[model samples]
Structure formats: C-alpha cells, structure tokens
Target: MDVFPLPLARIGIIGGGQLGRMMAKAAKRLGCTCVVLDPTPGSPASQVAGHQILGDYHDPSKLRELAEICDVITFDIEDIDTETLAQLEQEGHRFHPSPRVLALIQDKLTQKQAFAAAGIPTAPFVELSEPSPEAFAAFGYPLVQKARRGGYDGRGVSIVKTPEDYDAHLPVPSLLERFVPAAKELAVVVARARDGECRCYPVVEMCFRSGENVLDLLLAPANIPSSVAEAAVDLAVRTVEMLDGVGIFGVELFLTETGELLVNEVAPRTHNSGHHTIEANVTDQFEQHLRAVVGLPLGVTDQLSPAAMINLLGAPGRRGRPIIKGMAEALAIPGVCLHLYGKATSAPFRKMGHVTVLDPDIETAKRKAERVRDLIEISAEDHP
Candidate 1:
C-alpha cells in the first residue's frame, strides 16, 4: 500500500452506498483508511470502511462529527447538507469539489443555468416554477422534466411525449428541456487537481435502461470517429475547468444525429460512468479522486484495453435478502470481473453490482459482457 506522506491521511466519506464502498476499497490499497457516515448499519461502504458512524447524512450534528474525526471529507452521493459543509469549510475543514459546487449542482435548474452562463453547449431549457399541467402545456410537449433536487438512478425525471404525459410530470419545482434526438449518449470522466492540473478519460458511450434512465452499459473509447471523440474530450475537459473543482467529475453528454455534441449533466464526484476504470485504465477513478482530494499528484489515465461494463440490477418484483444466481457460470467466462456490492436486499431495478469485461477489441469485450450479463440473476431469497 502506498502511504500518503501528508497529514491528510484519515478520510471521511458521506453517504455510504456502493460508490463509497468502492472508494473505501481504493483507499485501503493506498495505505489510507476511511470513516463512513451513513444511517444504515452495515451499509455497503460501512462493510469495508475502517469505521462507521451511524447517522443520517442530512443531520448537521452527524456532518460535524464526521468532519471532526477525519482529516478531509468527501461524499458518494450529491444529496447532502451543503449549508453545514460550507460553514465547516469556512472553519478550515477540507471538502473537495467545494460546498459551493455541491450547492449549485444540488438543484438541476441551477446546474443547467450555470452551464449556459459558462457558454457550454447544452439543450435549451427553462425553469418551471409551477409544474402544473397548464404550465407544462405552455412549455410544449416532447420535453423532459427533471426535479430540482434529490434525484438519482432514473428517479425524479419524467419524459413527456404529449400533453397526456403531463399527468406523470414531476410536481416539484423542475425544468423543461427540449429533448434532443440523440444519436449516441456519451460520458467523459475528468479529474482535476487543486493546482489546476486536469486530465480526461477517453469519451465513452453510454446506453441507458429504457424508462429507468439508469446506465445500462458502457463502452470505453467510444466507437465514434476519431475527430468526434477528440472534440468530446476537449469539451469535457473545458467543462471541468469551468467548474474549477478539485476532484473527479463525470460529464454526461448528448451526440445528435447531425453530429452536434451537447452537455447533459455533470456529476461532481466519482460516478457510475467511470466504474469501468477499475480494471481498464492505468489509474482507477476512485484512487484518482483520493489523490486529487488529498493533494497528491494525479495519475495517468491511459486505457489498458478496450472494455465493456454492465450494471447488475436486482431481479424484478423481488424484495428480500439477495440470492445471487449464475455467478459460477458467469465467472467461467474469461476476462470477466464481477463486483457484488454487499447490499443485503434485492429490489426491482436496484443496482446490486456491476460486471466489467476487458479485451483487446471493444466489440469482443461487449459480446462477452452480454453473455455474462444474461448468465447471472440477482433475486430475493424470500420472495417468489
């Protein structure tokens, strides 16, 4: 393990989900330890972290306690008490990406506005102060409605194809964005150090699960033309530079049929899109994030191989302790790496884990990934 020769050794993580779990694992490899703050006992991250502080992430007292216990703090999820974090930062507590960035990103409308203000290319959008049917009708149809806060993994977003779909619109303060007819959805994970050093991973293509809006599959070094891919990397790097954040960010984007690229959203921490880097890159995103936050020099992000990754979602209509099926068979495939988050329960479409397939050729890796995907099933032991 590579020990940091600095005072910021003990890391505090908020929102102990799978992201936190993976981050903790990376920290261990770097000769560092993590303290996770989460309300659930034995949460995925808590299962591997050095210690767990059982408390809600939103509680100001719990947030303060976490800051007091560790040298520096970061978060796995975006839904956090930024007000408290800002105050703590004022008092000399270190929080990467800054509480200011988190506060702006917590609201979807503000994020879009910031992108526009920065001259970043994105689909035209407008805030809906009152998301009533009448208001939605005025905005026109075939638009996307996203809640201002507290949305993740396909929740808190609605696609309205017609006036009839307004019944399903998100009722909270939201934004209406003209849905760009995308030729391909892509993502680029960028890491920025406090000293203004920045690096971008190869632009990767993302395939989302229909109706859920969750990432279904990811292909590294996206199969687009070389020029397109370069443009994407440049755009993503510029977007992160604009934020001036000191950590990893996942910038989701849209590629229109006419070959136009537009920014969709930006995630300020380690993100699902970068999960494939664990086995495919010279430096994984988790370790890179730790490096950026702890004042270490960023590592190289060279792709070791073309890779394909798929999320392992829980079986539909199941709810109970998780019972993984077909693991033995799936592991039989060469170049397949399976990761099961120590989640105790299974629910419809819940992310249980992910599988990554690395191969010299991207197409071959994708084929093997599909085979492994079909061979495994995550079901609930106590449910039908």
Candidate 2:
C-alpha cells in the first residue's frame, strides 16, 4: 500500500487537545509532520506537533492556511465549521473523514436522525427549543436533554427527572430522548482504512461517575456473555461502515436490562474509551488512526492483555495550575501506565489525564484501576 510517500506527508489537525496530542505522537512515529491549529498557545497537541498554527478553529483563513500545508487534514474535536472545510475540499484539500461527514454529525439531533436512517437502533428522541414543563411531558419523566450542538464530556446534557428540572435550566436548540435504562454502557473502537478495510477492538464496559455522565472507569473485554460482546462489536462496526470514513471511530453503546443493545453515540475520532488500547492492544488507537487516515494497512486489533482505564479529573475547589499528587504510589503498582495531558490549568471535571492498568484478567485489571484512581490526585494549585 502506497501511503503519501513517507517523510513528505504532513497531517493537519483542527483541535489541539489531548486526542490531537496523542495523534501527533503517532504521526511522529511514522515520520510525518503534524501541524496543529487551535487558539490556545502551547496547547496539548501544539506542544508536541511539528508546528503550530495559532488561530480560531472556525476561521476560514486559518483553515485555508492549514489545508495548504498538509497532505491530509483531520480533527481531534467534533465541533468545527464544515462550510469552510467543504470549500477547501472543493479546492483539492484532503480531509480524512471529509467535511460532509462532519456536516451530518455536528449536531446531536442530526446525528440521532442519521442513526435511524441507517437502520441503527437508538433511543427514542424528540427535538426541543424551549425548556418547558409541557415539553418534558411530551418525552416523559427521567428523559435526557442534550444540546443540539456544542457539548462534550458531561456538559450540555442533563437528566430531567421532573418537569421542574426543565424549568431549572435555560433551553437552547436541543433534543430530548427517552432515557434507556441501560444495564451497562458499552464502547468499541473501530478503524477504517481509506480503501475500506475495517477493524474493531473488543467491547468495553463503562462505569460513569455518580451525578455526572462522565466515564470513571472502563473495563475491556466486558465480563458478559461472549454472544453479547459479539453483538456489540457487530453493531459498532456497522455504524462505522455506514459513515464510511477513514480514521478511527468510537461507538458508544447501551446494553439494556432486557438484553438488547442500542447505539448511544458515535465519536468520529479516537476516543476516551480506547485509552486502554495504548497499553493493551497490538496497535493503539492513535497509531491505528494515523495508519488508516494516511492509507496504510489497518493494524491488528488483538489485545495483548486484559486492561482497565480510569480517567484523571481535576480535583474540585482547586482552581489554578495543575499539581499532581500520589504519583509514586500509583506507579508502584505492577503494569500501570499514566498519561498526562500537558494542560496549564485545571477545573472541576476537566480531563487532565488517564491511567491504564493491565492484568492477567479483566477483574484484576479493574480492581487495580480503582486503586490507581484513588492514588492519583489532580489537584488545582496556585500557579507558582
């Protein structure tokens, strides 16, 4: 397979967050220059990339400049201006997943609609423009309210248990969904080559933080019936193939109490769920994304060991530069790896880093992951 002739190939990434940072590392391994564009100076990805373009992501001029210099352009974040990307693509700039794909998914309502159109089963949903009691009645109690656009990592989403809950928050253009009483939240990471080759990792079970939708821990090879695991993977793969895009896709799923699986959402780039792949799989998601987007052969998705991952979130009430505590105790555990995103500041619930614990069995990995989570403290400290 002829990838864009090695050392000459340059990749441009739209958002320079942790995902982009990891992708840049993978590009470096392949001897490709990664150019990151974001407003923040010395952002996570920009710090590691070959070069940085400091500008707003939605600025057409910056977009054009990025496209002009890179052989392939991709995004670390889902939110982007598709119109500018489309215009650039028309002028022969290459986007791995294509701006058209972004146009279809940039909004929550549109994304859910696409799932239905593709014959993928998802939770029942309705569009909303106002936060009203009647509107909540339409979807019924204990529903989910998700902003139609621009929400991530437990923000812009709320569980409305009562009609009063609707009145409590201001409304934007959003979608309300009948909450699925899922027994388990599942995720699968799949990579598709430009030539249509597809590969997927094993299903993972997600545990969310209480009172928040953020994932706290991920257990790979979810301790479920093999048949259920197969079904989850099949559903995830189908979702990616329907989108028909290069690069890696993370498919979030819900396993219901009655033994049915439903698609929760699809992230069109490398995801938090796949962080364990860095230590547990033959090829990590970042490298797999680089390989696929650049037209290299898809790598093996086989797991090297059972792994569990826990996200490192910033400690509440500490609002300044990040000061990590308990690193020595966390690392002293056997088969543990930590990854810190070089962010200068910290806030409540912000993702600062993640740790992956590997073990001979999934249960052991999960137990170790819990200890790692408690041992490491991402406390916000006064900048010195």
Candidate 3:
C-alpha cells in the first residue's frame, strides 16, 4: 500500500527505552505523533516524545489510557500484560502484531516449540519445570538455561558448563537446550507488511563480549562465505514467515562448525542487532517498523554501506551521571555516527549509546568501529 496520504495519528509506545525512542523518531519522520507510557520519569523515549504517561506496562489502567487517545499501540517490551492487551483489542483498540502473537512468544519454551512445529531448524530444547539431578543428567553437562519470561539483554540466560553449576545456575522453571558450539552468531532483521509481504536485511555477525552474553560488535553483511550468508537469510525469512508477524522481527541464528544454521532466538520488536541499519541501510529498522505497523508498504532492506556498530556500555565500576569521554577522538574518524540514549544514570554494563562506522568494506568498518570503541569510555562520577 502506498503511504502518500499518511495519517497524522498518534502512535502509542508501551516502553520508553532506546528502541521506543528511535521508533518515535521514525513516526515523527512520517508526520505522526508519539506518546510514551513508561514508569521512568524521563525515559529515553519520553525525552523525545511529545507526551508521556507515567505508569507500569503491566497496569491495565495505563493500557486503557494509552489506547484511549492513540490510534494504534505498540510495545517495546516483551513482558507487557498480554491479557490486558487482548481485552483492549476486543474493546476496539488496535495493536500491531496482536496479543496472540505476544502470547505465543512470551514464553521461551513455547517459542521453541512453535519453531519445531513449523519445521524450522533449531537446537534441541526441553522444558525443565524443576531442576533435578535426573533432569540435569538428561540434558547433559554444558547446557543452556533461559528464563521462560521477562528475559532480555543477557539477563535471563545462563550457561551450565559443569555438573556443579547444574542446580546453582538453573532458574526455578526454565528452558534447557544443548549448548551450541557456534562458529559464528549471525542475525537478520526482516520486516513483514500486514499483507504478508516480507523483506530481509543482509545477515549480520554479532561478536559477544568475553564471557558475557552482551554483544560488543554487530557487523552487517557478515564476513562469511556466500552460501553461509544465504543460509542465514533463508532461515530468518522462514522463521518470520512461520509467525503471524506484522512488523519488524529480528531472527538470531547460530552458525555451527559444520556451517549449519540454527535458530537462536527471535525478537518481535526492533532489536539491538539491527542498530547499524540507521546509518547503513536504505530503510532503518525503526522506520520499517513504523511502515509495517501503519499498514504501509515495507521499505527496501538494502544495505547502503558496509557498517559495524559497537555498543557503548557503562564502565563496570562506575555509577552516577553518565559522562562520555574522548568524544573528539571518536568523532575525528570519518563516517562515524554516534547515538546516545538519553539515560541519566549509569551502571555496570548498561547500554548508554552506540556508534556506527560505515566504510567501503566490512574490514575497514570493523577497524574504525574498534577505534571508536576504545577512544570513548562510558564513565560516571559522583553527583546528585
């Protein structure tokens, strides 16, 4: 559908994090107003939004309030009260991706089951209602445990590498799967229109921090063989096609030593793995999400440049007002674009901002991104 006569409707966002912030900006670019509902007084999205409602995402009253004035609502958080959203939808409030989609994806175990039912390639996994010696033994050592709900940004995942950690690291009720000895972790961001037309970005390679699940570098058009990249894209497209997705979806995959691609996870909203799209792609993920939600034709997912992105996490020991050091040095490098989330406080490993480095080649972009990562330090000092 053509969006020439786009409505100036109000877009309601449930969580006011950086993703919401960027999405709001994209909405504004298309002449739409954005309202945020978040508990944080001055969240990242609220800083940019025209109006904000201070309330919890799970509160039914807040959900109603957001639906009352907004044309359509979307959530940045996966933990929103789906029952409430369903009720609101029944009451004539519109929501992109729908409550049913959220219900299916809210649980890690169920998501994996869906992948299996759809005949998608994914790692073997099982639900562990309660961790036991027998259950641990069945899963074997060196397994992965993930919280069924409320997990994001490396918070609800653990790697049990030995028998000693089986009981200690296991969550109360979690999903256990065989640990993947991945040769590379790749991702593809795909946008699906309401009519089911889909387009996917080139595969991206994510480099995690040492011994941490957090991503340090996200490189686009993953430096891999053509066949591997094609496999990653195919898996991603198939994964999204299997879902009732009407917006942007992030499909994360693990490329094994034998070059087999397996689904790792999926994010319904705009994801960290696609942040470089803002500077490198013809249509950024944020704008693509807006297009998909607004019933407009999906934008081209073509890569405009070879790019690499580095997340600027707060210093491990620092906590206070955030102070970004060595900005001049980082900005001095050409083709560098820095984006700082308007977060007031800093904590260990907290995502404060990110920089995207674009160059003629992936190797050059990676090198430039490394320089920006080292030059700038996310630190904080004592303050009120």
lDDT of 3 by residue, 1-384 (tens): 544555567899999999999998898888888999999999999999869999999999998999999998987889999999999999999898788888888888999999999999889999989877778788897888888988888878888888887655754788889999999999999898889898898999999997557999999889899988887888888888888778888899999998899999998889999999998999999999988897877888889899999999999999999998999999999999999999999999999999999999889999999999989999998886
Candidate 1 least-lDDT 10 residues: 1-10
Residue 134 error for model 1, in Å? Answer: 2.4
Candidates by lDDT, descending order: 1, 2, 3
> Over all chains combined, what TM-score does candidate 1 have?
0.97
Tell me the spans in candidate 1 whose CA falls farther than 4 Å from its real position: 1-8
Regions more than 4 Å wrong, model 2: 1-5, 168-170
Q: Model 3 reaches what TM-score against the true structure? A: 0.97
> lDDT for each of the candidates?
0.92, 0.90, 0.89
lDDT of 2 at 194: 89
Which sections of candidate 3 miss by over 4 Å?
Answer: 1-7
The TM-score values for the models, in the order shown, are 0.97, 0.97, 0.97
Listed per model in order, the count of residue pairs whose N, CA or C atoms clash below 3 Å is 0, 0, 0
Q: Judged by lDDT against the true structure, how good is candidate 2?
A: 0.90
lDDT of 3: 0.89
**Using alpha carbons, what is the TM-score of model 2?**
0.97
